[model samples]
Target: MNLVSKNWEYLKIVTDIPKDYWSTKNEVVLEKENLKLRRFKNKSKSSNNAVLILPPQAGHSSNICDYAPDQSLVRLLLSYGLQVYATDWQSARLNQADLSIEDHINLTDDAVEKIREETGLDSITLIGQCQGGWQASVYTSLYQDKISKLVVAASPIDFYAERDFMNDYVDDYPMEFFEWLVKLGGGVMKGDFILKGFKSYDPYQHYIKKYQDLWKMILEDDKEGIERYKRFYNWYEYTQDLPGKFYLEVVEKIFKKNGMINPGTIVINNTSVDLSNITCPLFLLAGEKDNITPPRQCLEMANHVGTPKENIVQVTTKGGHIGTLTGSSALKKHWPKVVEFIENYSQTA
Candidate 1:
């Protein structure tokens, strides 16, 4: 927090990973000017089938593979000899002020097509992590033929279930206050806004985590632990604002209106995306403790799919929101199972 400490703090944030931990030469693709695309591969020449990964909200290229550190899901996929490609969302700024849900869907579709062209593969599999799942669902509905198979992980589709934490927050919003934030931040959500939203669920939890980790860092003089803390802090403390229009639409459609699962009330580009439009084999992974997206919400999504209902598979992993992505279940159980499920299906398919 002091002069020397503060500058060192920034260095710690960027330096944790050793250079070798990252895969060499990720092929870059562009869905649009605003949406940056990159591919992570384990082999020089790869299979026709590759997993298109969409990271959780606020994630970037580093989320998929940390070359400096020997950890990440991309690493897991590479170890299995499978190819992985991920999307890197541009941070919100004044210029991207008019971005909407349609833009996301279109950009992703563009990315899919680009991947297909680059690999010369007629078909490709899809994996959506968290809100990325929502985007994937929309894209699949819009371009049903392009996607061969779909996997939605830790995703919430029901939108309006009373128990969902995010829905509840949206429902209680003072429209004026939320709108004020949009106007102030160029129609994007601030990182602090999301952090405060998370804190609302359990205010002291994050603080406690910092304190506990700080105590360990100080007592043991653990440079590695201290360094990791700084790196995560840079990401955690750095807030990216989201376009107001998209945020409003998300509230109007997915949260307040809860339109994704029910009626066609939530209009995207004058067309309603019925859940029935999803006819591809779908795999949904839900965290039993995920209040942000309770398991029931995702299950309802499977109910509306036009495909054989039996083709929809659900894996109930144990963890809360992000934990579902990175905790014991992710590192130990869920990630492995997820890879196997997708790989087996893609191979047999």
Candidate 2:
């Protein structure tokens, strides 16, 4: 086809890209400020050890865990016959710009309690990924008895770790810089800003390589590849605004001050958070190739949690940041290990 024809066809394909389509096999049990708890349909024989999946709220939708049937962590958990629950944090809006870290943690607490009351399970296993991982740790520490087991995947804990590029990047900016940036958004952090930051981590992949791949698919007329790319890319292209206060606080406390592990450094609702209070069976999953939150960052939490060393399991699997979380191959190998670990500690009434 001629250049004009090819360009027009490309425009048509791009315009026809389906809306951010994320299929959920679960039902929304609770909804609060863009945060909702979802439970799979087969609750007939729920396990005493229910699983709660929390995807990072850093711009991307929670659908990352439920990206597709084959790439879904939700499907994997359901297949094991375990009662599964997840947090679906909606996009932040201008009116919700003042939401803070405490707000998120508190809402999560509400979700957890609701899950317990409904399921009659005393405690549930918490699975946190990336940003959610740290949030889970904080919640588990403050409410130790509410959780039976803890799993954090590809999450950053030790912010001061020498090899952490994210930490270094955060250090490069002053807190005031972030404050001003948030101000530009009128108190809400623009999702595109966050997207730009993520893309900045790897300009080639976000800016150049993806389009090259798309062009190749177009040229080769690879229908399957085209469909797969569209499915993943549409969701990726969709960004969510973040409450400015929460965004800045995370940049300050988690990334700048490294308060998560340090006692007296972080507090929630007037109560101090101490990671040592977490005595539950802890499982830390990291990606060996994950530069975003290197294995060191994810594994170091095991040292802080008071769980016996014998109760802690750390696995460094394959893939980079997003790959570790959603990569089909990594999920196939790493998630089964997680299921096995949770089973070991599960208790039924």
Candidate 3:
């Protein structure tokens, strides 16, 4: 009876989703036996900048949507005949809990190299978002000649800024706090941890929004609102747990101690990864309303790149962290500039 009831409810939810809720599918290219990349195609002109995109902390899979960066950036770039391919992140469980940040770096860098080798080009541009930005910056610092241009969107550069609340919230949470959390999560990161990141502003707003949306779904028999909620549930729930060793290193060294900002504080692959190595032209996009990672945090990125600060351009839009990529404002104002920035840098670099 319980199973039947659940099936009935799920069927009802599916029936309620609106006809226009779905977007176009992106081409999933099998880059490797273990890795699949999302290639956003644009047939027009050709440029030297073959973009090899990196995903967030989620780890490595190009499962990007056509409507989002995959489509939007692809369409825009295609007009100029530029090619774009995004790297998708995989889950820790499937890959085993063996990867560290260094492993992630190797995966990304190797992909960039392979793409260039296949394309018969000497270099490519790097577009990094969120944690991907941190990865890009680190890569630029280390492999300076590989990337001709760097575009970091909605990514936090300065951990010292009051951007990530978890940084401060966990600050004094006794070292035992992590131990308790690890046990509670049963040795893996849970959906709750990821969802909590969206609650720093008026913690109740999310719950209230969910409550209102559910009511709207029921009252109007709105299938779209229902399906959107369901898809969001899937993504929000699908979180990869960080390795205990990596988590300890990230929180203690990167977030709390600001090891990333401090030149000599961190080391990867036996080599010191420092921001000072990023001497190439850089473009930084920061959402003004982003509560998760503030603009102030992103503002400091230009200072470290070995290039003149004048080469760094910051476009501060008024959307939230994720909204900057998905919402209307980004399409109208932000993305155009990003495309142009890449175009100009591509020709000149």
Off by over 4 Å in 1: 1-25, 44-46, 58-68, 346-349
Q: Which candidate is the best by TM-score?
A: 2
Model 3, 246-340: lDDT tens digits are 55555566666676678866677888988888777888988888876787777678776677766788888888876665455686678778777
lDDT of candidates 1 onward, in order: 0.68, 0.84, 0.65
Off by over 4 Å in 3: 1-11, 14-35, 43-45, 58-80, 174-176, 183-187, 197-202, 221-231, 346-349
- Compared with the true structure, model 3 gives a TM-score of 0.82
Which residue window of length 10 is worst by lDDT in model 1?
Answer: 59-68
Off by over 4 Å in 2: 1-20, 43-46, 346-349
Among the numbered candidates, top lDDT falls to 2
| lDDT, residue 333, model 2 | 92
Report the C-alpha lDDT of model 2 over 144-172, residue by residue, as the tens digit. Answer: 89899999999888877646667767989
lDDT of 2 at 47: 49
Write down the RMSD of all candidates, one decimal each.
4.0, 2.6, 4.8
lDDT of residue 206 for candidate 3: 72
Per candidate, the number of residue pairs that clash is 9, 1, 14
TM-score of candidate 2 relative to the true fold: 0.93
